[model samples]
Target chain A: MKKFMNTAETMVAESVDGFVRAHADFVVFGTDRQCVRRRHLTPGKVAVISGGGAGHEPMHIGFVGQGMLDAACVGHVFTSPTPGQIIGAIEEADNGAGCLLIVKNYDGDIMNFEMAMEMAAGRHAVEMVIVSDDIETARIGEGRGRRGVAGTLIVEKIVGAAAEQGRPLAELKLLGDGLNGRIRSMGVALTGVTVPHTQRSTFTLGATEIEMGVGIHGEPGHSRQPFSTADDIVRYLCETISRDIDVQPGTKALLFINGLGGTPPAELYLAFNAARRFMEERSIPVERSLVGTYVTSLDMQGLSATLALLTKEEMTLWDAPVATGALRW
Target chain B: MKKFMNTAETMVAESVDGFVRAHADFVVFGTDRQCVRRRHLTPGKVAVISGGGAGHEPMHIGFVGQGMLDAACVGHVFTSPTPGQIIGAIEEADNGAGCLLIVKNYDGDIMNFEMAMEMAAGRHAVEMVIVSDDIETARIGEGRGRRGVAGTLIVEKIVGAAAEQGRPLAELKLLGDGLNGRIRSMGVALTGVTVPHTQRSTFTLGATEIEMGVGIHGEPGHSRQPFSTADDIVRYLCETISRDIDVQPGTKALLFINGLGGTPPAELYLAFNAARRFMEERSIPVERSLVGTYVTSLDMQGLSATLALLTKEEMTLWDAPVATGALRW
Candidate 1:
């Protein structure tokens, strides 16, 4: 793999160290290892926290700042964080207003974060919200095994704005759940990621082939198909996501097109152009749009489309100001 | 080519359309052209206007917003803007405080923007500054043929802030020249970019080969050598830059490590870590650092390191609050 690391074992740790040192003015390392928290804690406000594997950068860690996540427990690449790390993040984020865990519905992540919640039961009030908005799974409507991908940013922004307003912990949890339920996303990959220490990629495909419905962490998708034009793939992504959500005439959404690591901003805009055209024709207006690389798998050449059907009121939350490294606006 | 576009001919135009529409709140297209300008113009302030070839995003276009660029003239992919487009951008940005055109030092761009100045003569006051900081060229010290790369962002930020402060056109021009002279950058590429409709990369390398000093637009570098570890490359880049500039014990600089499009943020931090270590050992302090994909090539799997030596006062300007889609604080 063409990676920049001393060792695969320390790559995540070293990245965390570099990130903490770079943003030292605005953030600090959490008390209990492998977590990033704000430099100053706000007392008696609902605290928002999220965590997952380390490879998907600017996700959990980059979201730790003024208006977004309060703390982020960084696990090993494509691996769940330890329960102790999650507990520490909860402690740092909790300011007596209680804390909320934004779990990304992977079996490993859900288990570890819940374990951390149980571990912190006596110290602070904590709640959990499972974000399973990835609609690539066969049981999309059932929402049982759906994985959370780029849509987590939507949940984080909405829930974070409400939490920053000092909403009660219960209200914040409900906000996350509601927003998560309304969000749907799917992705296509032109190339798979090669993890550090591995010379080969997780999966290989022909030069002119694309994988549809792929997961972020090198997970296999429903099918390996022929490579198509950007407009056609965007149309396919939009159609799949709309089927999983309710999109009728006059429905408004925050269309977020994310580059999964290797796609350039220009290409992302290309996808956005096609998605916007597709939405306009279908009579579903994209009320707001964010096109860039957000939650990315390490060096994965792909793009994901997320359409979060928004309530008129919720639109205000999504548009609310944020000051994170990745999602600042 | 693995690009996202409806057609190669319309790729740049379509991306501009989507970008203007996505950021419609903060920006708008020029009255009758492809240029992007602030939605609400601040007349009577020294307008900071910049433009060049597209593809290196978040540089000239993404830098547009509150405290940075007043207008950016975007051109076709890897091609300079037309004289008409640059003229329109100047007309939109100038509000009697005079307009400053920040042009990258490319033969085509210099020739075209200069032609535009001649076209807009007497209609609006205009002055120009050329940024030529890329040090990888054979005639590096001569500075005439040096192509401006990632270092252009530093020139834009420093000059933009001064312009926002209502500095006169002459002062902004001087600041742009001073900052551009103080910046130096070099890059290496692991993979070449495939322009739309080309169906092939600009260059090819063996599995374990890397091209040193590659330009942002797939321009050939000085040499292609065997792939090395991140630390080794960081060492090479730092040593080369330090030799070009002074690296005495007490020197302070802003170490900006940029991803050349396809390199992920994790890998960028990896590069940052190596650079920090190298600087620390040399006793050359990196007073401030900005790490992310600021300026990027289109799908070029590589990275560039830019070190802008700064005085004590310049850090405050770098830390100034600016709001744009790509950069915010």
Candidate 2:
């Protein structure tokens, strides 16, 4: 594991410190650096907060800014944040209205966030929206439900826009839950991720193999297949996602092709074109498109395809203004 | 060898098609898809045109939008654009105010762009800005001069903003030439880049080896050293740049930490923190910071650092609004 880092113990902490410094004008360290929060909080607006492991960068933390997440509780790489950290974020972000937690569906994350919600019950009105959009996990019947992946950004953006509009906490929660139903995503990994601390990949594959429907933390996917051309790989991803959502003909979607670290922008765009072609053949037009490395699994050479069935109103929300470290318009 | 591409011959073209489609609202293909140009042209403004090989994305093409580049001619991966392609860009971008061509200092690029200028001489008033800001190649005293690296973005951004303000061709060229002198950059590669056609790395390194001052095309660098910690590597990069540019103790700079490709955001931020500390120790304050994988060598696992001495006027230009595919503010 030839990573540009000092010691694995201090890597995540140093990265958090550096992130705050790099975007100081937009964000600040909150409560002994337990969380990163927007520098300027909006009064009487429902505060939106999110938290997770550190490897999937530009996610919870990068989303902390105007018109998006109010605060992000960061954790050690591939580990869930402590309840104290989540509580600190809640304390720093809650304004007169309340706070809403947009959480991915993971056992550790759900448990810690729930513990933090209970801890902060007396001080702030807190509601939670758990996102479980990875369709493969649901099909696998893990009994723990699906694990959220790249589609979290869609949920965050839409709910964040609604929050910025001063929507009631209940309404925002409902909107977030509704989005989870419409968004479906699946990912493929060409190379496994090596955890910084362990200095070892969670799994390994043969030279001509690829993993389909992999989770964000380098977890095993549904199957391993022979390495194929870009068009075939992308066709599989788009077909699986669209099939999972039962997207109908003439339906419009926001096709988001995301790189899961290590994949260059050229390949990401190439994958986007393949996915676009797939949708066009099905008569399912992709009304909006986003392609980049947003959520990542540390140095994993892979990409994910997400399709969100767009309603006219949801389209307006996704198009709404957002200013954050990783996202701005 | 493991890349998401359809075929070597079609990879760059497909990527360009995908990029134009993804950003249709902001850009369009020009003249048989030889270039990507702004969708809405601003008449009478000096058109800022740039072009180069395809691999380093979010640079020439991603910069084509409002308040930045007017057009970007693209060539095959790691190959210079032909004179015909450059001429197409000039034709598509130029409005009444003429055009400014920002060319990176490469032998092929310089020759082709000059040939294009000669071919289009009678049609439009054109001026050129040749950027050669990589300090390592200069220190080596090669007769060909330094290679332009990540600092080209600084030249494009400042000159692009000036062109957007209706600066004439000559003035924009002069401004871009001035910027080239103030900016310096150097990169390190942990692994060599693999071209899609070849399906083999340009160079190989031992498990504990790393290359310093590596070029964007995976060309040989100044030295190959044992793998070091992030802090030490960043220290070497910052110290080398400061010494080359003779950055005064009280000077201000825009510290840009760019990922070549494959390096994740967490590691990038960690490197940024080390650089910020290095400048702080020298009393040369970093007035602004930009970090991301903007200019990249396809799947090269490494990063580059760039420093541009900032004037109050240049600071304002840098702060001006820019809405592009990869950059927005």
RMSD per candidate (Å) reads 2.1, 1.3
lDDT of 1 by residue, A87-181 (tens): 88887778888899998878899889989988998888999999887888645343358989999988888888888888899998888887888
**Model 1 global lDDT (CA atoms, 0 to 1):** 0.83
DockQ (CA atoms), all models: 0.69, 0.84
Off by over 4 Å in 2: A139-141, A248-251, B139-142, B248-251
| lDDT, residue B237, candidate 1 | 85
iRMSD of all candidate structures: 1.4, 0.7
Which candidate ranks first by DockQ, i.e. highest? 2
Q: List the residue pairs that clash in candidate 2.
A: none
- Residue-by-residue lDDT tens digits, candidate 2, B34-144: 889999999999899999998998778999988899999988888789999999988888887888999888888899999999999999899999988888876566566
Q: Pick the candidate with the highest lDDT.
A: 2
DockQ of 1: 0.69
Tens digits of lDDT, candidate 1, B71-176 = 9998888889999888888877889888899988888899899998999898878899998778896353433678888888888787787787778998888877
